[model samples]
Target: MPYSRLKNLWGGTKSLGKLKVIILSHSQQLVEVDELSEACGLEKIDLQGCSSLKSIPHTDQLKNLQLLNLSGCTRIKRTEVEKKIKGLDQEGGLKETKSESMMFSTLAVKLEPGDNTETY
Candidate 1:
């Protein structure tokens, strides 16, 4: 098993306050997953190839999140995450983030070109 990117990253420090990106591809573990929400400046998160990872914590607090990669998290059910994402979108949570511009293009959900956002 490979080293955990997260554990290795914060090993030298007790806290990571402004973490922006975390790429944990193929890491042995993705523990403390909920800690992501604590980082206020979190942007892109890459969990590609983390086959051991099953479910991901809802990250509505990570309003700055731009990209998310769960391609290799075979255990993760997209339907579950879609529901959470939908909830966040409805509350104008994710839409306020900078990555909102890429949400429609990247995710299955689509925001019409001229449609009123309030009703979307």
Candidate 2:
């Protein structure tokens, strides 16, 4: 859902055992997904433009997650994203291919025109 009014995603999500993708792009007020960790089978979570988001559930418990698109999330630091990816890499949770690494690198370093803030 884009441009949604949600501030958080909590109750009732734990029962989505077969859920694979969640597209909450541009939900500007969204700050958290409290039950995200319970969605073990999720593969993609696209929170692309959620500018007010502060944090997400830790990636360590997301064994089946393949993509987490946090692009344009101005409240999240690039360093934090880098650290999470690094930890996932160390634990073999993400593919170690050059192209995949490059993609994350690009996402982490990308900056908006005239925007020098260090956030992704």
Candidate 3:
């Protein structure tokens, strides 16, 4: 439908070696999907805005992807994410569940507070 934000994005001519995670909140552009898939080498992708994004690209290529946040993304499919999650789960891989999934009141997965400390 709209082709304004997708201009000169997914050309696939860049090498993203240092990227780890990608958070596309309120970015309603489709042209960058492929480019992002190629550039970020992203392990965690948070698509919070794209309500029209129904498909995901290059799942096999993103072997390092762990957590995918699609909280507000109603249009995006869950099967792709589910498949990835299942694969990771089977292999005994670990993922950082977000604050919505778990309630720690401080951190999601003890990112700062270690096990030896008690804040009661």
Candidate 4:
């Protein structure tokens, strides 16, 4: 779906049933995904390159979520994302696995200064 112009994921999108994955990569204008938590079955959410995105919904309710790609999201703070994910892990929301943990770590590393220049 074309989400390049999307600013947020509110309203009707929360009602989508059986949505397993949503890739809104490079949606430069996107700033929020507050209603995304309603998609409990989501396994992957790729928001890579969404430079303007500032925050995502809490993951405590997304028990099935496996991959959450926030690479290149320059506007978001790595520490904040890590805090939220760590809380989710403690709550048994995301499935705990070495590779999954590594994925988040790598994404956090990529958020460092000068690392946001990669284009889609």
Candidate 5:
């Protein structure tokens, strides 16, 4: 199922499974997934074009999470993202991917008005 639309399932109140990877591209505010990190033991997540995604979800519960791609989320401040990535990396309980240096990698790309840029 699409992670972005998970909230819509069963009227915005359903716990999800432990997702290995979640892609939220061109989505609106992803605040809906705030509880997902805790409920599902979420790991890798990609917020490529979600311009409305301004803040990073609290990820202390996502212990085993490794990779996160926030390339084109223009509303998200660079410093804030940097802090979140640094914190996640410091958690030090998961095996990270080779392509993902540290915890997050922001690929260079152009952001649309309501859409974030592209990422792998």
Candidate 6:
């Protein structure tokens, strides 16, 4: 089911029971980001380059959630992601990983496109 465009499954979904990954890489119009809360078993998610998306709801409740991709989401911010994936670290920041150590110590990675050369 990864990379499948289940546009209607957001609010309609009830459970995913240990589903490890999901991909929504490029979409034309996915405005509501809050409906993802229903999938509590999700571990990784890809919402990269979703232009119409404006915000991501708080996802601290989804404890299994780990990797997140916001590489080209121009409107999203680091603070917004920090606030969403709260409670992962002591100071409430993205966890540091061996491959990519984000600004936070929680299990999160905020991507911003800039001439600075960054991550997702």
Number of the top TM-score candidate: 4
* Candidate 3 TM-score versus the reference: 0.50
lDDT of 3 by residue, 13-109 (tens): 7776567776665556642365555643566666554555555554455556555544444444334444323233222222334421211111111
TM-score per candidate: 0.56, 0.65, 0.50, 0.66, 0.53, 0.59
Question: For residues 1-120, what per-residue lDDT tens digits would candidate 4 score against the true structure?
Answer: 435788977666447558889989889999898788788777778887777887876666676676677766666654456655522221212222433321232233222222223221
Q: lDDT scores for all predictions?
A: 0.49, 0.60, 0.44, 0.61, 0.48, 0.54
Instruction: Report the C-alpha lDDT of model 5 over 1-119, residue by residue, as the tens digit.
Output: 33454322134555556556666754654533454455445566667656566566655455555556565555565445444442433221222345332232364221222222222
- Clashing residue pairs in candidate 3 are none
- Give the Cα error of residue 116 in candidate 4, in Å: 29
Q: Which prediction has more favorable TM-score, 1 or 3?
A: 1
Query: Given candidate 5, what's the lDDT at residue 44?
Result: 69
Inter-residue clash pairs, candidate 6: 93-106, 94-104, 94-105, 94-106, 95-105, 95-106, 95-107
What's the residue-level lDDT of 78 in candidate 6?
A: 55
Ranking by lDDT: 4, 2, 6, 1, 5, 3
Residue-level lDDT of model 2, residues 1-120, one tens digit each, is 778989988655358778888989889999887577678777778887787887766555566776677666666654455554313321212222333222222132221223223322
lDDT of 3: 0.44
Better of 4 and 5 by lDDT: 4
| Pairs with steric clashes in candidate 5 | 49-116
What is the Cα-based lDDT of residue 111 in candidate 1?
28
Q: Write out the backbone clash pairs for model 4.
A: none
The superposed Cα distance between candidate 4 and the true structure at residue 99, in angstroms, equals 28
Error of 1 at 36 (Å): 1.0
